[model samples]
Target: MARFRSICNTLEVLFFLIFSAWSLGNRGSEAKDTLLAGEKLRDGENLVSAHKLFEVKFINLENSQNRYLAILYLFGYDGRAVWIANRDNPLMDSSGVLSINRKGNLVLTSGKGNSTIINSEEPAMGGNTSATILDSGNLILRDGERILWQSSDYLSDYTLYLQNDTTLGTETTREKGRQLLDFGHSAKRKLWLQITVLVLIIMSAFLIAFIICRLKSRYCDSGGNNEKNEENDTASSRLQLNKFSDIEAAYKNNNASEQKLCGNKDSELPLFSFSSIESATNNFSTTNKLGEGGFGPVYKGKLVGGQEIAVKRLSKMSRQGLEQFKNEFTLICKLQHRNLVRLLGCCIEGDELILIYEYMPNKGLDSFLFDPMKRALLDWRTRVSIIEGIAQGLLYLHKYSRLKIIHRDLKTSNVLLDCDMNPKISDFGTARVFGQNESQANTSRIIGTFGYMSPEYAMDGLFSEKSDVFSFGVMMLEIVSGRKNNGFYQTDSDLNLLGYAWDLRNQEKILELMDSTLVDSCSTNEFEFIRYVHVGFLCVQQSAADRPTMSEVVSMLSNETTSLPSPKQPAFTIGKSNIGVESSLSTGQESVNDVTISVMNGR
Candidate 1:
């Protein structure tokens, strides 16, 4: 009896300690350094580094109620945000949540289902994944023990940084919801509130059903079928039957005509209604149409908020419509650059596939560069600036961007000019992302403007950064001489732009090729004009190995003193101007921008 009493006392003490630890954990004192797969980091929860110097959590930037997942300084009261995950996309309200999906992808999803950001790379071990914050100030996404990705790689150009702890608790989330519910001017807030209430009610229903299941397992073991039990079981089954049959879910699927937009689950694109866009584009009226391109008609629009936007509507009859739309939307949405055109959002209602972009007041470069009267406006200084800007933008795409991309269909029309004549690269439907070590990729479908395509890409479908450089070279020549390369009919030596430029460079009379409009103004400094012509030749070299990388191109263009390598004889494959031109031309379209679909060569 004495020994048993002693054992009982020890057991009680052990139980007391365990209970205290659990209580402390519940009170937010649990210092967890890792989040396992299938688990979640709630709006206010945090993951701290092992050394506690760095922490990551969703913080409301400046208490603006716009929450972002950011790295924060753990030990300091003074706030500092060094790196942000969703900087481009902030959680609108408290409904934002971060979790590891079943596929082991890191996902940040907002409450109202508006925006969903997913980081999907290598597959985690069947959801047996983990996210850890290390002393090295790295947030690692892991699959079991395998390291899938690291935040350090994403922010290599940036130094380590963080902010003060500002995690939202459950109560805080509720309070945020309440504030938005009562204070928000938009009806969307009320809908968000409804979503929150529905979530809570769903959870409650799940708990009740679980309890009922447990009771049935225990009480119905003897196969007893009493009246009350039968009625209860019948009612429980009925509830289960009705659980998935919500009116909203049914309506969502049935509303085909409304086409209430929802961005693809993987993409972080915003949904825009068909009606709103119709209003913005003035009912897609003929007068509002900006111009037609290979994709479709582009319309200038003004949103209800007084923001101007350019809308690209894909042709309904185009064969490559869906694939091109997905490619442009998914790829361009991820890339951000001053030289890159920004996609505001897209509207996909029924048969209409439309993309909205930040409106460029001056329209495409071709509008000014090729026109005899407008060409006078582009002085030597402006042309040089445009060339440098294009080079820098291509450099970003090739080296600086998170993914190395090749802009396959690069030309004058795809380059839009802003209010200040700043060039922004657009029309990325044919752009392809390359692996870190990949030098080039092959495609059976030769889809790009004919004259601008490099010989290698034009003949063999081999494309890389060099192919874009080749295109840039052709455009540079056109900008200087005010000539169009598409079906370029030359009476002199039967040479295309590349061949003609090559011939001029060999004779050292590049000044002859300069635009006639700028002859008197630019004659004082034939040196600058000749140097640009020299750089253009280097870019259009026959071999991809001969063409300088965009970074080197920028350096050469910037520093006139930099000695340039003599360019080799280019391929000059357009033996007859119309030979390859016809093969690359879109069906039933003579003008470059008229066709809404690219000619595809079957594999």
Candidate 2:
């Protein structure tokens, strides 16, 4: 009876082993969870089912000497890595063991007692801690479903900023929202030991299989063929990576973007929580939005204490949004001038890149100067003051500031007006700074609005302080005539606003160039105002050398006693070229001239 019982026990054990192996082999990979580490963990394998937004893997830190245990983010991004676990004490080899220990501790142990314990104070025996994967690419640890720790809440890498609801410009709290996990002295040797153990396990399994194969040669041949097939699949995957143009696409297809690359903190900017910005914007209410730009929409938000701010949120479709955010933040933080718009702060939580600015009651200058009815409100004196203010601002950009900045795309729309109607140069999105004595730069990908761009910048991509002066010149003419540079018309001539102004100036019919609205409201001397037009013409000269520097322009505008030099012909006359969208001057009726004035590359 004892011999029979022993035989039955041996049969039962063999059957159980066979069943487990069969279940593992035939269960299909669809049930795999990303965060789980064990037999499911394979080299270059993406677990899609566990967490669609993250991946499990090892990666080299960006420009670092060591690698780390991390989870890579796979969401609305250009394949950014976030949330590192065991950042400081990473396993040296692929064989390192990561698993929940018997005591409910998230333990990482190598050979010879080398170990790391991510402890939960109230850990419930073996089932105390449960690992959950979040949409934010975070793996959380819970004690009986209560979160004890989370990867997202602790940011050790600069790329992994936690999303929370915090106001822009205010100092953020560390514990209140999230804290950066530091890479300090911890259990690293034990992790290395576990890697060795893993290798031994794999070797032992292969050795056992080899002995079995000797006994059953035919069955072993089939297993050897299956291994060859796995190798072929792996080779095919490597070939796919070479076929893709960029790293982003390759990672997405394989669902490998969630792998964390680094554990270093290199970013200097403070993290703003998503909840704060969301609550402030009233959940991105349409009513709070002021307008839209190349980046995204602008929202008018009021903080906790009723502090009003204008927030520029970069849209997901904005291809250059990240570059713009980094550029604007780095540039705006160092710059300070009364004529320039003040950057309150920026929010870069998740895909959102938000810029907060002081609210301007009068909004942008373009809104007033371009609108016919609104233009009438600005008399000759107000217009002249605005032009002078703009000149001062430009002068600061060209010479007075710590860094030499070129306002590559200066236009009336970018100029904001305060409550007192003072012009403040805004929107440094397209602005570029040059080293001392560096005069001009060129880019194949040209950017900036039409009509305001200088001939040199518009055609050949050459830009300098003179380019800004040329834009200022165009704006000057618009202010003086109360018309848009691209959409000006007279019954007699087909010339654009600038062309007509040039024609009138050429014929010495300077009085005709004055805005009729200014004529009715202002008691200021007409001759003095026409002198402002003369200065405008000088600044708008086709040649950069002929156009005055901001300092010279400021001097010319400020000194009423100084007689200005004769102005040259501006670029792009009606007979020379058909430029931007042509628009009609008539109200309630659209004509050929009403077409939006477009400017082409000049002679």
Candidate 3:
């Protein structure tokens, strides 16, 4: 009888293993909870939380060609995005693919090779990592019991941010709402507007070109008559022409841009030849292109000595100007920190301008943090380290740098990751400096990514060091939840992330807002995590006067037992919705940008 039982047990175990393998292999992309290395979750492939509470899948934005990976309610056509893998840089088409690369990072790559790194701010867990969608609706990347990254940190147990009344300057909500209109702007009227805009652009282009030619005629031959002087003059003239052409070509038709680049290139940094860069990047082949941005394309290259580098190349007609380029180059060159991206060298020849840096194997932070499969790999401790690293980098920029600078654009995409998962702040295009006595400043032209913009800066164009604090607060919430503020919307309220957090705080259910995945996985101080949320709330208070400085934030985060202050209401909360929806299973489609709530003025 004992021999018969043993044989039966062995047969059962083998059958179970065989069945599990078959289920996984044939399951395709549906109803999957875990993903091992070398597996893929292609576009339209999705999964639901164990209790059927939430769903994760790829979706195209309403009325827009771009695609995004979204997390929504289980078994529902009622579309809402809790987290997006590629928010700032949405995929151009629907050929989205979610997979674990050899580095063990979760990546969303298009069929055309455009890839978004989802959980990259953390170190890669190698091939041993497995991505799992948890019962708590948290996507975690883990290596056995060791957590490497998780999506919960991006929006930890949170809803998407409510976007209602985003105004351009003092424009009323109705006026500002016009920009959010994806359709209904009469086709004929739009066509007429397009033609009118085209005419204006052409006329403006002619005027600018004519003015540039006059300036070239004036500066190209200013002095000297002898043969040697003439030769020297010609060479100098060529160099000047090259500078002008590169700067002008690099920027849109902006005044005094070429002069800014010429003036800012003070010879402190090495200038590599275009040929060397061309060789390094295989002549900027399409395959060599790593990514694209508002400025231009970035390419991965290897120097002759075998040093891997990333080159930021400016398109001939890029909208980024010489001033922005010079600011980033000069600022980064002058600043040095482990928390900041290193600048190796640069190239400016003719109509081509390129900035080179040490290659980062991990890529951008958003790649990993927002990816469902890879987020669990971050764990809690690694995430805290990243938060501190970002704060330190910001501290360096705000206080320690030679010039007190404000990083106007501080978002997940701008924070890069090294091979070891260290956080480095990059992209200083919109950074502004201040004198020792200067405390605050304002600009008519507001520049920043949508989701991370501070209340004051986004609304009134007023920015100080505190402006960065507000952005940090929003980012802190995102890190805690793994969600994007711009995409978070509620049919019930205009509360956005801040308002919802305020409610949670008021209700003393703040823990409910934390990444439920971390509730059990994190072995570190639970108080510390809660305290970070408190600090975030304090930072994002409605009034800038109520927010703490970065120094205070650092201190608070570092010392858990420090005394804390109660947070006030957050800015831009219009109110909640009174209307009711039928059900989550309702088959009717809703626009992603549909606005049902009201608005307010002051931040």
Candidate 4:
């Protein structure tokens, strides 16, 4: 009897210990709605809203190893993240903790001893401040009614919020109120019982129907079933044929109206449906239209998921035809560089031909460089960065890219700026690729902006990498001087910008050419500014052979120690009158507001 009692006691002790551990674990897993000062929320723990609509915790994104603290929707299985605390600085491990430090600021501390204060600007409220996750997916820090910080004010990702209609005496609110009121113990038991009975009845009816169908199918007459099967197959075949014919009709329409699809050769590039594009751009409303270019009208659009995009639609009246559209799509899709604009996809349906690209918030370089009010924004450092970025992009096209491409039309308007003011080269409609050993090509059809065209290309139809260098040099001069090349002429002399810059260099008054707005920044970086002008002069030399290669230009701009050779007089600097007469007689085309010329014959 004593041995049996001891055995029972041991078993009871074991059961008690197991139950205590299980209870502790369950409590730990339960999410809290508030985080007070001096309390830490570890990696595996979460702060859930009172209504269970949203959750805040550390999460590892799909296919990414880094962990981030994010607020996510809890109603959906996907748990889409609405906001992230540390998006750019993610924790490499799971050992991350969220807490309000002694200073009453929300801080994220990693196991590696690095800490990030989320609300650094908020004044310390001692132990009175508390962080709470609201049902509206907003995380707020408050002391009583006074709010210190809130997540809704800072939008990092997609927009998400509960509709106010639900709380304003709607059917949903009434139903929720009814559910909460009928929560007595006996009422709940009766409700569960009724639900169980209803579910059983539904399942039993489905099982009976399933059994009957199976029996009928197994015992049915063979001839009738065979006829039915044949009819179904015929209907399926007709459906497939109809789909194929519809595709064929679309192909024919595309070929008749505009450029045809390259037939799976460019299958890797996505083809956006016409309806989606229309919806994204709000039917291409005038408000959404960004600007018009040589290709056509461009519009700003937002996808269904709140992703912004720029749509380049080819206008029916545009001079750029099938060749230019196809050229831009094919070349830009293959070329990848940091300084180049990204092509997302294209659209070709009926007479509609559109190209989708990553939206640039700051638009083109000319918008800031030419606008008097905005010119001050481009400080000396920013101008230098843009110059270097343009040079790097040209070097990539000329030597580093898979194809040796010569951008026939390089101008300020073709350079886009991102939100960070980084320059990206765009518009590949007039670019041409060359063979590995080929250095230059001749074309009677000269297509490029007027003032940017090189002397050889304009006079003799000979174009090479040197021609693009010449265009870049012109742009460089314009960026520094804040004057349009074709419009600006010396007061006393009829010399254009190029000739004026040459005279300034000779007289050692190069600073006179600097933009008035850049005076403050130019004071400290005067030498760097003069070096850029010297390099620009070297690029626009009269002889193509005298111009430095794009690679050499990059080296000179990057390495200050590199020696630069003296530049000869650039072409088209022999007074505007003589050069204009010669150019008109040779190409038979007069310069117009620096517009792109599609067709010009060489002499």
Clashes of 3: 36
Better of 3 and 4 by lDDT: 4
Residue 432 deviation, candidate 1, in Å?
Answer: 1.0
Please provide, for model 3 over 1-603, each residue's C-alpha lDDT reduced to its tens digit, 9 standing for 90 to 100: 222222333344334433432342243344666777788877777766544435678887666778888666342225445456676778877788888877677888887785646664666543477777653346777654345677653222111111222331234543444543333346535744665576566556556665665565456456423445545665766655545543433322111111111212111355689999999999988898888776678899989999999999876665454556766765666555689897777886656778998898888887887788777767788778889999998987787554588988787877898988899989887789886568899876666655565667666678899889888888888788666665566567666666677788889887777765576665456677788888888888878889998989899988867899988876644333312211211222222222111111222
Local error of candidate 4 at 91, Å?
44
TM-score of 1: 0.60
On TM-score, the candidate that comes out on top is 1
Q: How far is candidate 1 from the true structure (C-alpha RMSD, Å)?
A: 19.5
lDDT values, one for every candidate: 0.69, 0.62, 0.65, 0.74
- Which residue segments of model 1 deviate by more than 4 Å? 1-191, 196-268, 573-597
Query: In candidate 4, which residue pairs get closer than 3 Å at backbone N, Cα or C atoms, i.e. clash?
Result: none
How high is each candidate's TM-score? 0.60, 0.53, 0.53, 0.56
Task: Mark the regions of model 3 whose C-alpha exceeds 4 Å error after superposition.
Answer: 1-268, 491-494, 573-603
Give the least accurate 10-residue stretch of model 1, judged by summed lDDT. Answer: 156-165
Best model number under lDDT: 4
Ranking by lDDT, best first? 4, 1, 3, 2
For candidate 3, the 10 contiguous residues with the lowest summed lDDT are 252-261
Worst 10 residues of 2 by lDDT: 582-591
Q: How much lDDT does candidate 1 score?
A: 0.69
